[model samples]
Target chain A: MSGVWGHSGNIEPMFQSATAEAVEERLQRPRGWNRRNSLPYTLVFLIVAYLGVFILFPIAQQFLTSFSNNVVGVDKVTWVGLRNYERLFEDDDFWFAVQVTFTYMVFVVAGAVSLGLVAALLLNRKFRGRNLARSAIAVPWAFPEISAVLVFLWMCNPTFGVLNIFARLFPGIDANLNWLSDPNLAMPLVIALSIWKAFPFTFLVILAALQAIPREIYEAAEVDGANPLQALRHITIPEITPTLLLMAVLMSIFSFKQFTLIWLTTGGGPYGGITETLVLRIYQTAFRFFDLAYGATLGVSGFVIVLGLTLLFVYAQQRQDRARRR
Target chain B: MNRPGNGLLLPRSLSMGRRDFLKRTAAAGFAAALATPALAQNAKIKIPLVSWMWNEPGRGDAWRAILAKFHAEQSDVFIEEAGAPFNEFTNNMLIQSQSGKINGALFHTTPDLVVRLLRGGHLEPLQDIVDKLGIGDKLSAAHDHLRIDGKVHGLDIVTVKFGLLYNSAMFEKAGLGAPASVEEWVETSTALTKSPDQFGIYSPHLMSEPGDFWFILQQWAVMFDGVWAEGRKPQVNTAPVIEGLKLFKTMYDKAMPKGTDTATANQMYANGRIGQQLIVSAAVNIWSSSGPDIYPSLRSVVPPGPSGKAITRIHPICVNAHASDDEKAAAKLFVEWLYKPENYQELMERCLDVVPPYPEAIRQEYLDKQFWAEGYLAGKSITPLEIMGDYIFFNQEFGNVVMDKFSEVLVANRPVEDAMADAQQELEKASERLFEGFTL
Candidate 1:
């Protein structure tokens, strides 16, 4: 009986020793040369290659194009290094568009994240028809952008738009306001539409993060005589802070690149470029004016801005990782 | 292999060794490979004739019918319709030109786009076709811009001249006749307007539709005998141009649908809610179909201002220079056939077009039948080249600067003089970089 038990234990050690030897052999080999390690490296190479072709290549081309005199119908295309950049520096419209982009980004990010957080907190509570509420909140995220723009155009129509009815309900308002055409209201209305379209995505992400929190933490806080608000302030918020930071970075990116909603709504005008962002400016320069070199210069500037956003995202992810470890 | 539902069963006699099977397959494939190009050569060369008119309502059907006729009469070539909507077509073509080749073997270009394409050398000179057709001496003055180095690169297919197209029923109901001067025009328009229910006039003022706005905006200055530029020098700050902008503002405030888009404005015009539109002659065909009730009552007149001149823009059909030699030859053949006196007359009639590309393109009898033809013909024809001057190549860019500043005049009630002054400065600065390395 003793011999039988010893033989079984020896078989387990033998299996362990064989696996350890294989691992040690792998470690002894030079990095990235082992046959087994090639799978991950190959996968990584594929991802990097894909990004290089589709993303980095275009960016490199645009950077090169920025230094050329490449306007359509020009007699010849030649390098005019720094001339485009000098023009960009002096361009009033480009600066105005930059200012508009930042304004739009700040408003949309703050509006989306705060609204999403509030909605997520409310929906986090157990209640009747909670599933229906959760599904209902995601509808805007599912709606197509072009379809939304068309519906928004109809709703803002001065003559027959349903928005006019609501405006008329106000005390001082007697006539239908020119909603999109009024320069004062155009930016605000465009921002509102963007928020409506964008908030649902943030809401979903925040809700997922909220659900991931353990119920025991809350139960423990309640046992310590902490009220709902205190528990929310100490437990809920601290847990979700990383997610909120991540969402802010993502929403900033989203609003930074928003084009179709604002374009189809106001076309960067009721007068002037009251709502024009850098993307629209880039399009107007390249496509409308056929000033490809200047457009490319604007594109390079936009790339720098996107690079900054990527760094912000990386920092946020690192912070989230640190928090998770704690 | 003979099992049910497994695969097709080959007869034992038809079965072959692997090497024999491979050889037979290779021989059959070789024969197909050899025969493919021969078969293709015998088939009609299908060439796409790209034009925004293919997407237009009545114009689309008219062009398709003309294509069918051309197909019926031909054996060596077939023409197919290809194009985007009007708003996108010019930009699409421009992008194609930038890429060193246009998409189709043939394409129609707007008045401005034709100049750009000609300068880019994307158009094969159609002088031979015009000369072969014997219409060279009779081409309209609007075709002047299509000429380069004494060779015509394109042939005019449609000439849309601006005019005051109005719903006569609305004017009749309001007891008004067409105004002969600017003051009367404003008074008549204001009197006809009943806000929210009716608008007396509409000229695209919204920045959202810059193409239509700028295109028609050029004509407003023309109404006052003003040219936007003269030999690459902007004349936006001139008195006539200012007056023209002021007139537009007055009409916008008191008469026009303040913020209406072109589509909605057209709908309003069709319903008799809009009295007048300072639009092109080609638009009449659209109204004839969309607004059948008002179509019979529609009449056009010389726009009311000091100048009776209207901008006559010729859209030309050109063969793509970059197309294969075979495709180019086939496309030119279609162009020649389409430009034949009889075919051209039939096309003009079907399109409800009054303007003839030449003296003989439209029969006098047919011209006499079009009641809407008088105002368009009576108005002096001012080609875009004459107005835009050397800036003809940079028309949209020049127009954008003017439009942007003038938009303030309409929306924020900025003084026209101040706005035009700013536009003049902007245009002067832009001209430094705009005409570099290019000759008129």
Candidate 2:
């Protein structure tokens, strides 16, 4: 885990014995900040850089695994030119995993953000137990993801499951649905669990944004012959849209990167490799299969995809916001 | 049906068959692939018993008892049994075994690994230890599991058979004695499938790993006609293999009861509804739990085979070769003490109708009292050693490739001979490229 500011050679010796004048100069504050604070900055940089070796290095290692042509039992690398990448490209299973991931993110984000906004708008006024409810919404985020996944696995069990028993009351629905086992059902079930586990974050963010909206703007709207709906649309929504966009981006990244929950409930199997996310693939390749190079390749692929989407999103959002501002 | 987001390549399985063909055509060659414990010279040494089964509660706790007994006032040296899940026990030890993080491990993997482990000097050579310990004198030809390149790797528990473990009541109704041969097993299975209401055997074909189809079929093949490993080469695709396939296909085709959906089934037999479970004998504890409402009454008899002898596959036994000299010596001594008939009897007697590993370990007094076998059935004892010794499990690379081919025949509906041909082709290829890394 190397810090971005780290050096290849030891910087420790450079900072080992700084003169008193240098130390004193670094401590002194000036109007434009003329003095070089190399000692303190280097120390901070090195500390951060040290953490990168453990954390970032392993991540880099996973990215490396996804590319290499290492078989589990075999010890040599045959270096099949993009053979792994080529295989991954043609794999119907990986395509399904990608679709599942997209569906999960899109459906979850839509459900959580819209529902969260409504809840936040409804709870805008001071009410009894309001703070308690707001805090309670954040509670799901604190529960361990593994525990939540297990709970979902149990609730979704086809036989003797609580959800199936209750679902039976519906006239046309099957009495038993092996939610996790069905390739058709696993993603939707995972989407439901993801929404359940994640909506609270949206609620918290939206509620904070809602509270921060100035009452004066709404008062002006009301005075201008705007009904409650128009006032919310014209004033409230415009005010919180920026924060909502930011939260959406963050939440999208969070959902895309979510691993533990999916890994726990369904070991990314049943669809013959469809359920496995790129991250899960990285994990399996690096740890389970010990194809570190291939695991690393998965990480790199996941990174480029996620990064490209995020950048494209930010660029589009910025352009739209700038035009509106002008 | 839709394309995956960020999917960069085709799937492994679809391409595996084709790539395997090309690779096998290119490789088209073959190759061949432990030891007893060492005594702790100074009594200050400690070595690890890296095994898988000890992860279960009783076995893990019972390991402590054995260690305690061995240390019985022997002042200083200690032995620790560190167990992980079956899958992880070896790979975890590999880092230590390679980097010398920890000494010796007891694990099971392809027999092809023996040459690499010995080549990199990752394991201590053990033929000398067996000679020094005089264990060979006690047991005839038992150390073959470890013998590779004319050297030994580790002492191993023999192979146990994968077969139909039937209830006596069901057998009475079917009028089938222990299947005397593979043909009889097929006949009995088809007969017992009598009405749509009952099935002869319970098998988990859909279990995650396809390897299990081989685990059971190999036992049957070994009995009828014969498939074998000589100098660690799998001369399968023999008559025995074809006969074994037909036998299994016969069972799967006509036997398995309807409504016994095995999707992600963790325990089909624990509930005890199946007349007979075709599974490994390791599940005895699940069937032996108190409360008839909860558990099932189960016993095992040999499925009569082509040779009139029912054999099984054995879990492997190994010692750490990478331990310090003193530690290696002590590990050998400890293992020797452990394999002594008394200790062997102690471990084998628990929780199942397990056959003893060593021939001399099962005495009348010990067999009668051990917890797993006590009065569960009329059978006095069933030792895993009744199955082939290390020859099948650890001596050769053939069983694995043959097993995969067998799966092709059974599940994929490939012709038995064609699949065997493909299997032999692939296996011959796999044997050559098994290990190329020389780093220690």
Candidate 3:
């Protein structure tokens, strides 16, 4: 255990044994006897308590609510075990919302990350007005969501939207297009707005990650007769793959819970919930339809989907880490 | 520490010991605690009157004047304005109610919202106030839904009935008189439209504004003598509804400002760009201020459809059951004062409202003076409860299904019959779960 902190070739086993011994010793000590050791445990307990109240408790409430007949204005809100879940499985609209949520998540995640990477790579180079360019790219992220939606609504307005100006530049689009009302265009327009509002954040994070990579790595690749593309492929990409993965996970979560932008813009419609995500559906069900029990059921199902996504991403990350080590 | 500028030692009396400072602070806090109720008792009972009308253009000012008059006349109660915009108001109140109480001691409820609140037991019955005012028998039939177990739970502050409100100036420009039939209405609208500049008609169709969209959509069905539901059964796939939707689609394609939001469309209407709107009569007040030029030319007609019936909705102001006894009493006092024939008539005249909750609530002389009232008065009145049957309790939900499917007809060019068939099936399926224990 003493050699755990020493420069040893067998460091992993020594560290594990030392950790085990420390835990055993701490447990054997009288409560509050070791203030230094107790500090970390106290902080951990505080965090757990915070999470339990703010996150876990509400989730538990929603889970309990999912099994009840708790609709607003109902005569009795008695427990109706498994009834809501049974209905969920047969509900077509709920399934459509799930599909829409995933589609939105994928497109937004991919679009934001790709656009972020491109912008980051471009801005990372030595260029004139680079600072100004970086500041400009961050504007969208800084802008309030409601304001952005308002501006976007104005720009996509059928009669007077500025979007029509650019749209009519192409032949055969002679009339002002119904940018959001058209079912074919609603989802795409909403996705584009989400990406625009989201990509700036990804750009800032990816830029910081790019700056963290040593310039020597690129120089080393250049000295070995590597072209710019080869250097980018071998040196730059490999160094940032982990950051990109992390961004994808973060973006997925951001888009998964996105409500204001979608709710404000298309309101989960042009027709038949073309843009309805799980969040919007939960809201419409609970607030609009006054079906709290079913809304909770939908929420629980969404929580499961999110949990599955997180586990899948964790597994992928673990595999990637193992590959990196190899 | 030395005092600034003077550069002299501070007086010994200026500094106090920590214990003395703590004692003084605690004494001040204790004094405040003791004095608070006395001060509050002396002050007016500041119970907030929550209403979406507070955010509306003409209605807001009208209500504010009424509130001012109330303040001038009363001393014990003070009503503060609170609530969100029209679009968010119902859901905000619903959310508040779901959490055990509404946001304010007194709040306004839409035609559908009062029913939910009444069933949820969130309303304090105002039958006593009505009886005191002796207007219970004079109350319009629209107030029937607000009754539960023989007690009136709310008092209608405004009764909004739909009509084909059009700009006679625009009609004159197009050399078209008011249409006599549905086919004539379509031809007139198409003829009046000059795309990219002016639209012939605008009824809220955007899903982004489902509250307005669904509210107006119900009237569209009514225009053709159709109801969305009957006895918890949907009549969406029926012939009259199909005809109503087809007419809407034809107008959408040929005459509407396809993607314009209601606010912008209203501005367009004010500016004489939109020729007509199937709007509530209460909305006429907006033109008096915002569209002074066009307001004079504005005239309403019975919807030139087979039915010639308009859906009349009553927005009621209710006292919160969850409020304290003092607050509830104060709210009821305000309601009683506002419902007096003189005050109510003044409110109607100030708001330029044509409909009244009771006959004596309005003056025949005032009605005669309103040049635009003829058509609104001529139409047969149908309440939402009658048109929707038991589904009136789930008005927004029923409207959502209808609006969602019909959006396909407007957007994807899906046939109205096919879209409506899908809607009929969806509604049929939803009824099983939505109306499990619901009694109307």
> Which candidate leads the pack in lDDT?
3
Q: What proportion of true contacts does candidate 1 retain?
A: 0.48
The residue-by-residue lDDT of candidate 2 on B354-425, one tens digit each, is 555556756677656434332222222223222322233232234444553554454446787887777667
lDDT of 3 by residue, A1-326 (tens): 22322232333442366687666753554553244446789999999999999999999999999999987776567899999989999888889999999999999999999999999999999999999999999999999999999899999998889999999999999988888988889999999999999999999999999999998988888889999999889888889998999999899999999999999899999988999999999999888888889999999999998888888888898899999999
**The best candidate in terms of DockQ:** 3
lDDT, ranked from best to worst: 3, 1, 2
Better model by lDDT, 2 or 3? 3
In candidate 3, what are the lDDT values of residues B1-440, reduced to their tens digit?
45543676777667668998999999999999999998987788889999998888778888999999999997999889999998788778877877887878999988878888898999998889888888878888888888988789988888899999999999998899988799999999999999889989998898988988998888888888999888989999998889888999999989998878898899999999999999889889878888999999999999879999999999999999999999998999999899988999999998999899988889999999998878898899999888898888777788899999999888889999999999999889989878877766
Candidate 2 TM-score for chain A: 0.80
Ranking by TM-score: 1, 3, 2
Candidate 3 accuracy as TM-score: 0.87
Backbone steric clashes in candidate 1, count: 0
Q: Rank the candidates by DockQ, best first.
A: 3, 1, 2
Q: In candidate 1 chain A, what residue range of length 10 has the lowest lDDT sum?
A: A1-10
For residues A1-326, write the lDDT of model 2, one tens digit per residue.
Answer: 13333332444433764888655643452423222446677888898898788778867755545556654433454455575687677655456667767777788788778877887887777899988887787778788886786567667755445787788889998646656656677666777788778888788888888888888888887788899888888888888888778777877788888887776655554334445676666665555444455555666777887898789779878987997789
TM-score, every prediction: 0.89, 0.67, 0.87
Candidate 1 displacement at residue A59 in angstroms: 1.6
Candidate 3 segments exceeding 4 Å error: A1-50, A159-165, A168-176, B1-46
RMSD of each: 7.7, 19.4, 9.0
- Itemize residue pairs with steric clashes in candidate 3: none
Flag the better candidate by DockQ, 2 or 3.
3
